[model samples]
Target: MDYLAATAEKKYLMYISQNYSYAILRPLQQEILAHGGEVKWFLEGDEVNPDFLHQEEQRLMSLNDVKEWQPDIVYLPGNIVPNFIPGKKVKVFHGFNSGKRVNNGLDNHFKIRDCFDLYCTQGPSTTTTFTELAQKHGYFQVKETGWPTLDPYFSEVENNPYEDKQDPRKTLLICSTFSRRISLAPKLYEQIKAFSEQGKWRILMQFHPKMPSELVAQYKALQNENLTFVETDNVLPLLKAADVMLCDTSSILLMFILQRKPVVTFCNQNPDEHLVDITDADKIEQAIDYALTEPDELMAKIEHFCQQLHPYQDGLSSQRVLAASNELLLSNPALKPKPRNFIRNLKMRKKLNYWRW
Candidate 1:
């Protein structure tokens, strides 16, 4: 028997569409390699940086490569898994499912589509929701291994907790979801301008990768002596650098929450009492003050929220996810994940335009 075929180790294929998700999936790749499994990578869009591939350039596979290899498992960080893809389709999810009202909230983030064979949920809330959805929909398996994106926070223990820069100025980070309905950037620009003009704090703005470039340009124009706009694939380091965060329903808030820092969200429909919520644009400054001054009062609630979302601070979620992927690969029925729902996924494909099929 061929060594690749005879060995118990499985082959894993990962589809990373956005650079931001790269860090989230890296740990899983490391774990699979450690377990004697072969790992292949594929970039979803033109945004891929060839330099990032480094020595692993040979491991980068195309859609045709995916068809030829037919790995035992497929991991996707986003919702759409494409039609007729080989292997067990697992949804590792891009971020927390905070139930923001985008497209009436009917997307697969809340509803189950047939393309995913398994859902590796981020926390208790999401796991419970998807577990009920799995039972109700009757098509998939739900596992509550905390999101691998967050594994870095737990596993790579920090020697020093976040500390303010030596400069006396407090730092503020602004992040938002992409939906026009819920995105705070559009609504809060004028206020942001006023806040930045104050010159009291250092401000950094990072947008969702999917946020429109025109809108990003508009925000970039606001940059001044105190405010800076950042466009990057990774937000983790910035999250560590900020003293407070302002966001509206982006799962990125969970990352900041894990650091036990206070966040202020604007126009958030599904509000968590633990977050400082502001409906009035004029109240943005007050919210910032509260986050900077009263974070201690919210520390208990923030910790409670973190525990409920993910109880494990052990940093082994990637190993758990890979282990679960292997178990499913061994026992999952021959049933392939169904094609994307034409009406829903088609519109999304036209909107995002990444999948070749």
Candidate 2:
């Protein structure tokens, strides 16, 4: 029954650009290790801190190193991967489409880049679109394997962070997307400071990795007895600890609401019926109060929305992802050949400085 006793049979490579991938892939890594598989990380982009790699995990430093290691599968959290890389490039996705704007006659979330062989979609919200896209592309397969990142989230023992505090208070988590055009971080500075000093709730502030340094610093200065600013590769714990979330169009909202908690959004791109969305800064205080109370009608809407977003609460999502990958390996190749985008592939090759044919 113990597969861990066997020598690692399959090798998996985690190719990521954001630090968030550490949290996302770690659950899958545990599953892979349990199944007698090896996982190596290939971190690209300046946003990913190499220091985030755990001591037990190994990082393949270069494109050539990845080739030399010869992984059976390369799991990508970002959109694009170099075609020259060996193995089946699988798109695991970093976040759900949090209603970011579509661009250039294309929807950002559903864009079919020619790089991936299989798409491990989160749920029906994404699977339906990707399935149709796969039918159109004829070169990639789509599998509705719930995201691997939420495995830890669904399995972990819930905690109340204020358990030991002399004065117990509600926990509020503030997360903002990095996009200046869509982010509420800058506008929320004054409001957050007022909330911190008000001491009605325990506040946690986490910003996107690419959020402006000055804004991050400004929020950092607001740390006090009631407010705590944390920087971690995993945001799940914060999501678990908070009673309610205060966010703007960040996918973190979708992730939090999946926990069946209320969210107060600030002018989200597509403010659906689920959120306590407010357009005016003055209404934030009122919204937070409503969210914290967890109104029955609002709760019903959130529950319905969560089912549409991510219905898997069993925490075996990682296993499903692995199973999907295995199915791909055992199945026949796509009916049609994968199309090559010279410009995108060229950019990737140049970015990695890999020219070997």
TM-score of each: 0.85, 0.95
* lDDT for each residue of candidate 2 in 100-178, tens digit (9 for 90 to 100): 8589867788888788888998888888998999898888898887899998888755564423346578889999999
Worst 10 residues of 1 by lDDT: 1-10
| Model 2 per-residue lDDT at 239 | 85
Q: Quick one: best TM-score, which candidate?
A: 2
Model 2 CA lDDT for position 251: 90
lDDT against the true structure, per candidate, is 0.77, 0.86
User: Could you tell me the TM-score of candidate 2?
Assistant: 0.95
Stretches of model 2 off by over 4 angstroms after superposition: 1-8, 157-167
Query: 1-357 in candidate 1: lDDT tens per residue?
Result: 232222246778877777776777877887777668888887776766645664863455566677788778889987776655678888998777677645664754676567788888878867878888877766688888887777677544454233335658998999988989889978988988887898888888899878988889998998987888987665677787788999998878878888878989998777876799899988889889988886665877888898887777788888778767766766665444454478766665565553665
Q: Count the backbone clashes (under 3 Å) in each candidate.
A: 0, 0
Note the residue pairs that clash in candidate 2. none
